[model samples]
Target: MRRGGDWKRGTVERPVGAPVFDPTDERGEETERATSASPRLSSTLLQRGKSDAADAEAICEAASRPKLRKNFVPIKSPEQQGAQMLARVRNQFIGRRTQLANSIRGYAAEFSFTAPRGLSRLQQLLIDIRDDTTVPNLAKELVEALAIELARVHDQIAKLDKKLMQLHRSNEMSRRLAAIPGVGPIGATLLSIKVVDARGFKSARNFAAWLGLTPKNHSTAGKNRLGVITRAGDGMLRTVLVAGATAVIADMRRRGSRPWSWLKDMIARKPPKLVAIALANKLARIAWKLMVSGERYRPASAVPMPTPT
Candidate 1:
């Protein structure tokens, strides 16, 4: 309920001689020899409170439950943490790059020197502004400064992308995930970085749900009502999956290639955005199975994909 164990990430070590089932941390660990851990929820129905003492009491009660192991936060190695850090920084740079590009475009539009969309077009727009004599030199100077910053951000992103590519090449799981139809290098690398242990997920659907690819349930009176995707889990990972799915659909349409029957049917009935989300969900499930079972991907989806392990 507290939205994953992100609040407790980093610097916590699985002590050299600690039990795998019982991990010790600075604050607490659920072991007979030390303090028991209770992953705090957004709100404990058993006891709603606003003070530290009340929170501790609630945590103690929650830890008394019989099945608390599933809620334990997965500990990360230094390498895994570094990988996540790299991916996050790259993602941030990408966002900043887009923002800077848009700002430059908006400012350049004032001078009636608008360029087409796409990052490549941004550089050309800057060139046009540099050459245009009618545009005020002052405005040009400001835009030029933005362009410089944008270039710096772009260089940083490219460097990080190269590092991720190298990691993907060396990581077997990432390579296997990239084999999935809708998952490219970036999406595959994200899955590998985020999913430390595939076995921890009971099934493919659970993995998909964890990635926030599944629909939300709003059922009542024994009537099943499904809403839009919950959009939980890692926002960046989900976004990459959906973007990759959208690209896959576009390629399929442009080349007039045969898509999986279900995908084709969905495309026919659903709006393009909805179809992309569905395809992304399928990709997430497929990725989960590959990670768990170490199976090769089958492009032909007519043969059903493996159920989540």
Candidate 2:
């Protein structure tokens, strides 16, 4: 089934008693692009009685539809899949490191040892735990174990970071994407690999919407209501984009000069988090344009230079 049309959109069927669900649902294990049941192509076919033949027929029915052409996901090469695996492993290691650090912090706090926030402060707390005579020896040993595990995780993450950076340096498209203000090596590389075919998206807005950066639609007759982001795509990708945007805004604030007038005005009027999401959405759209048009980023004109005093 995979050989001729693995990328084709098709229907998913579960046991007869099971309730139907969207294959592209955000809560599914990983994003639906690779592991999808091929929903949008045929989510509306909820025929309940499901045998293997019935499922195949349903899939065939969906694939036969002309509209399914618009809904297909890109078929990733082996190289792209490998890059995704690396990103995922690195993400897992980073998360484990955070978990270990938090556990160490909580344990040390119980024994009246504390350090200010920040991962760097964790090492100092670990040293304090090792040297403290008043704390129970058993607890000290346990905390030391956690600290050691955390250090190992940190080293692994560093290794993965180095490898990902090398990949970024080697890819022309990734390098082009890195030119965006918020997107760095990691973000650029991720976008490059995950979105292998830019034309799969209808437009830049569609690309941003696919990433779930857009507001949820709650429109009624003669009225418009927007809610939080749909948050409907690969969670990691969205997180990377948002984090990059936050760093950009933070730096702009620290330096006391907005790079663009619209950003300055928005920051003045909107909440910082909301501004970050907006900026992230813009970044996704810009990335899509770069991928689709094969054009390098052309930054918008900056705030006018101050006249010489």
Candidate 3:
């Protein structure tokens, strides 16, 4: 069937035991929209025509080709769906909160009341503005309202954090995944829920490529060329992984933590943001290995302390 509004509703109402196939076009864009049903089928057949009936016929014709059915997207369980929803909601609130904070900062700048960086500093600035006699009453009231909204978003995010933490504790796989240096409760839980079976990927590199962490290859003849990441898969997952990598790099730089000597040298030579992307690619490979092998990470010993001269 052509997967659309009414069709989607009907597909969701199908018997739980029945087999359902979701077909993606050549671009592979509709994969995630099929959270309930699967295995996914890829075919150029669906692109034959834009009409609903033509699309339905194309799906039927595509189903007949055994070669086209080789690639299938795995079906996600209800639990995983719940976790994805929670993550999406939390992400939405984070964006809104940032917008409100920026608005507060922008408006205050017009009055030459520049606040220090960071959320705490912004909140404090709002309080000071509220009490200052020189500030206009209308401006004070507007800024106060923004502060209240920002506080509300903060409270909601905290509630989601508690929920994610509970899920992280309950799931053995997520807890095991949290053993990785940069991975926290949110990243662990998201990975567990998003990737049902890392073993399905043929190799660690394939898994990293699937996450779009690997560089794009454009090779012809004997010469080979590479470009930036494809940015083609699970954008939210990729974003969080990069964010975790950033945090790890920042902490290591500040504390001079004893990471591998090669990594230290790379950090010194490369731009920090580029290093973070590279680290995130390595982290993806490590997570794939751990997931496939069913082993928790074991940290290497810290660099040997120097002996007294």
**lDDT (C-alpha, whole model) for all candidates:** 0.78, 0.78, 0.75
CA lDDT, candidate 2, residue 144: 79
Estimate the overall C-alpha local distance difference test score of candidate 1.
Answer: 0.78
For model 2, which pairs clash?
Answer: none
Off by over 4 Å in 1: 1-52, 64-71, 300-309
Between candidates 1 and 2, the TM-score winner: 2
Candidate 2, position 211, lDDT = 91
lDDT tens digits, residue span 113-201, model 1: 89887998888899999999999899999999999999999998989999999999999999988988778888999999988888988
Model 1: lDDT of residue 194: 83
Model 3 scores worst on lDDT over the 10 consecutive residues at 5-14
Residue by residue across 109-187, what tens digits does model 3's lDDT show? 8887788778889967787788789899999899989988999999999999999899899999899889887887788
In terms of lDDT, model 3 sits at 0.75
lDDT, residue 35, model 3: 28
Score residue 112 of candidate 3 by CA lDDT. Answer: 77
Segments in model 3 whose C-alpha atoms lie over 4 Å from true places: 1-48, 56-72, 301-309
